[model samples]
Target: MNYLHWLSPDVDLSGDKAKVPTSGASFVKYFQPSPPASDPPHRYTFLLYAQPADFKMPKLASPLAFDLVSFAKAAGIGEPKAGTFMQVQG
Candidate 1:
């Protein structure tokens, strides 16, 4: 899900390597994932992209409404260079 945003490119993944930092050099906390506790186990996938030097953050009504494709295009981020996933039981 496109729900987590990381504000700094210097994001620290040392705490939880499984969770990727969503924000980049231009924005912070654009979206975040929320797996309901009542739901069954779910697999969370993350796509890592290379942000362009001219990348810019897009305006949004809410982080929940953030769209991955649109955001990537707007921010000049190309297709994911790498990816990772983890399963969570909620």
Candidate 2:
């Protein structure tokens, strides 16, 4: 499941490292990772999808049931341009 989601079209992608867009971005969902319950812990994934200027974000009732495939189908966004994951235990 996704722990956080943010979108920003104004962000400059040419930099050596990630930086906030000059126009700023909006968070579809806040970052909230639950305490790991397993020995291996739970994996949290971050995805960076290229949002078109005409892209319309679908209204989600709950993030709990959020599915990437379903979301892409609804939002009409293409495959993720970048992504990463991590397992956190606390």
Candidate 3:
């Protein structure tokens, strides 16, 4: 789901690879993945979106009961550039 949220406001995409020392970057929401114990495997999807230069990061109250679709719609980041998913067991 929405376990982790990391943002790099200004990343250096000049090179072939993205540099790590991004400007104004941080994890607004710390990583906290809690795969179910009973379920042998849990599916997780990750999406990459482009943010505007002036886009602002938001503080979340909690990961619980969070709606990612609504948030993405409000952010207006448009369609995701890339996406992938993985399965994990608790």
Give the top-scoring candidate (TM-score). 2
What tens-digit string does per-residue lDDT give for candidate 3 at 10-82? Answer: 5455799755553454645345456778877866776667777666655556655566776677667778776
How good is model 1 by TM-score?
Answer: 0.60
Write the residue-wise lDDT of candidate 2 on 62-86 in tens digits: 6665677888888887898888987
lDDT over C-alpha atoms for residue 19 of model 3: 56
Error of 2 at 36 (Å): 4.8
Tell me how many residue pairs clash in candidate 1.
7
- Cα miss at 72, model 3 (Å)? 1.2
Against the hidden reference, what TM-scores do the models get? 0.60, 0.72, 0.66
Model 1 poorest ten-residue lDDT run: 4-13
Clashing pairs in 2: none
Model 1: runs farther than 4 Å from truth? 5-26, 30-34
Residue-by-residue lDDT tens digits, candidate 1, 49-90:
665666566765555545878877776767877778888775
Residue 10 shift from truth in candidate 1, angstroms: 5.1
Order the numbered candidates by lDDT, best leading. Answer: 2, 3, 1
RMSD (CA, Å), each prediction: 5.5, 3.0, 3.1
After superposing candidate 2 on the true structure, give the runs of residues whose Cα lies further than 4 Å from its correct spot: 1-11, 21-25, 36-40
